[model samples]
Target: MPIQASFPSQEPLGLNADLIRKYNQPAPRYTSYPTALKFKPIEDKASRSAMLADIEDAEGPLSLYVHVPYCRSLCWFCGCAKIISTNTALADKYLDYLEMEVRRYANLIRSGRKVVQLHFGGGSPNFLSPAQIGRLDNILRSSFEFDPSAEISVELDPRTLSKSQVLAFRKLGVNRASIGVQDINSKVQEAIHRIQPTETNIKTISWLREAGINSINVDLIYGLPHQTESSFNQTLDEVLGYDPNRLAVFSYAHVPWSKPAQKILERSPLPTADSKIDILIQTVQRLTGSGYAHVGMDHFAKIDDPMVKAQEAKTLQRNFQGYSLHADVEICAFGMSAISQSKNSFRQNQKDLDAYYKMLDEGDIPLEKGYLLTPDDQIRREVIMRLMCDLELDFQARGESNGVDFQNYFSSELDRLQVFEEDGLISFVEGGLEVTPLGRLLIRNVASRFDAYLGDAKQGFSKAI
Candidate 1:
């Protein structure tokens, strides 16, 4: 199932500003269908237990998402669910509650399913000491089985990440590491209040490579305050010199309502909308020109990168933690604010630490809100994911696989897509829909057409651009 992706191999992606501005509306990232914004309050324990039963009966491995929400300090530019504290003792206590939460799930998730993928995301997973990281790993291993070659990855903050911690990560079977190099320019760093010089990232990468963990990923952000195209190109040049295995060049989403820390950034002048677009266009051109294969939606990988392999083989998937290689693996997440994704449902842990601990102390899973997938949701999920990951959708083949006439069933949606086609963002092929290079930048807008619940509901999603 080689999904046809006509994205240019090394050529710079061309941009049409008129099309970009028209489609630069707010839209879900399609990381999960029905979107996290649709999650409702869990009715009772039955709903949760039923989801756990589905996970147990499901016939595949699991993907574990361990959220360590603690951070050493505040980066005003960040919008993640993070708790700022310099107190290391708080993390040790958090771990105790985390183990209890995992145990509660383990008692209910009584199955032989193993973990094929494991990701550690956070304010910063490296906020913990080496011993704490080891303890966290031990807690997870005791509850669930992990495949021998599981794709284990962690997010690191070079400022806080230590060589000893990197060694422990390698010893504990982590093969991939992603560090944030969100504009190494001193002024940008000062604006964000996270003063990490490029030397920090270099030292961190050296430690990781020395520990035999070489699948490196670096995250870059556009649309930051005082970011010019030239300034960002300098950052890109510095990062390209490192030759990362993969790159996630994301557009900054400034949502002050959800993340109060972001309001502080108002003191700094942000790049104008036009300036942001220029930065985005040049970033795409630079990465593609430098021989990195542009994987869907802000991610770029080397031709030999596993992510590129997954995209080519049609196994690439989007999740709460962005893109993943395993589409079938159900996610069982632990820790505060962590989201758990089952075959037909999604649930998140309590976000507040006190509330999270209270639920754990009561010997219950700290479930906050969740959404169950309808049958229509399941079908649409596959359809939208194919469009998102493979960058195309085969009507005939997908019709057979999904047991519906894709053309007839989605007739109205196809009609809606015509506006994009007219705008030159997408095109209709012989038996499928293909996103043109121009459309790739606004892929969310194209994927949004297939969303059943997107009925003029503003889900507070970031702009499609």
Candidate 2:
């Protein structure tokens, strides 16, 4: 069935300028509690094999994440693990190694394990040839049985996406897609080095819909260079015309130290901190006012979309992909720099392509780093995920489930929140604390309070605002 959607009346959010200014310092996006920055290097494959064995015995449903780290060229503001190249031979070689890696895991996982979700994400997943995408899909399907309700999705750059590729996605049973159109303003696109015209994106969505791919997501970046309030409003209007089922409005993280390409943006006239806040306010007003439900931080979905349903049902989950609906499925990631997650641990593949290929050639998993969640890590992760997804926390219920007083356990964190509470971004209710609408945009700051690894506060994380 096509994913249905609706948006109820919009709630007025308090845009606390003062609070934003105070808390708008470097902070993690909280995709994971410890975050990948805290991942410890794994020297061998024994632990990985053991974990897979444990999972196989449990025999739960699964989610597969395949990373394609190739892009035709670099977008100056891009921070993802990506390789900017157009060499088909390079891509073909990577896929050959990827097949070996997938087969390795497939052998470890027992037969007939169901895959409920599969996602292809990267620098640009569509950079591969049509046949290449099909081959990857076939290899995965051959290894695991796909659930009838499986949701297959991909992230593609509209500038590089083509009609034949859209047809290929349909052939592979891709039901959902996210297209990148950071900004429609020519100057902004020029500054960012991603020059996709407005009509090109509209046409891409049209093609996907015509090919029976109805669940569409469009990504927009706020706080980019030359992004004024007026220009951002115009971009929002242009994007709303596409009427996407889901929207991800991300703040442009300008971490030159982490992503050297971002250094190119240094010479450009970027928006000031206050101006970025204005742009964020404008974006929220436009999207929420236009009938898009504010599902959570930087994410909006149609009221009836599965994400919204997940939120209403309190089953919403947050991972590297941001907000997601399937919480029961363990994630298995393939390709260089892909990160996989099970209930007990998070593992990452080798970030270097050469190292990844060498490990596969040596008949071993190209595992580089991972974090095995301790009992404490798991509890803290639960708290952070809840605050991020549901925007509220029931202290009593949380404590009851874990056999500890949540308030007493997290007293320091709760005490730290006094600043947010005083600033009116958050408030205490009947049994627990509630993040006000003002706190929604600053949810990362709220979630960070519970992070045990976020010491020093000097780490190179993006700003909260």
lDDT of 2 at 49: 62
TM-score of 2: 0.95
The CA lDDT at 109 in model 2 is: 78
Per-residue lDDT tens digits for candidate 1, residues 115-140, read 89999999898888889989998999
lDDT string, candidate 2, 83-149, tens digits: 8898856788888898899888878777767998889999788998889888887888877889988
Q: In candidate 2, how many Å is residue 246 off?
A: 1.3
Model 1 TM-score, all chains together: 0.97
The models' CA-based lDDT, in order, is 0.87, 0.85
Evaluate model 1: give its lDDT.
0.87
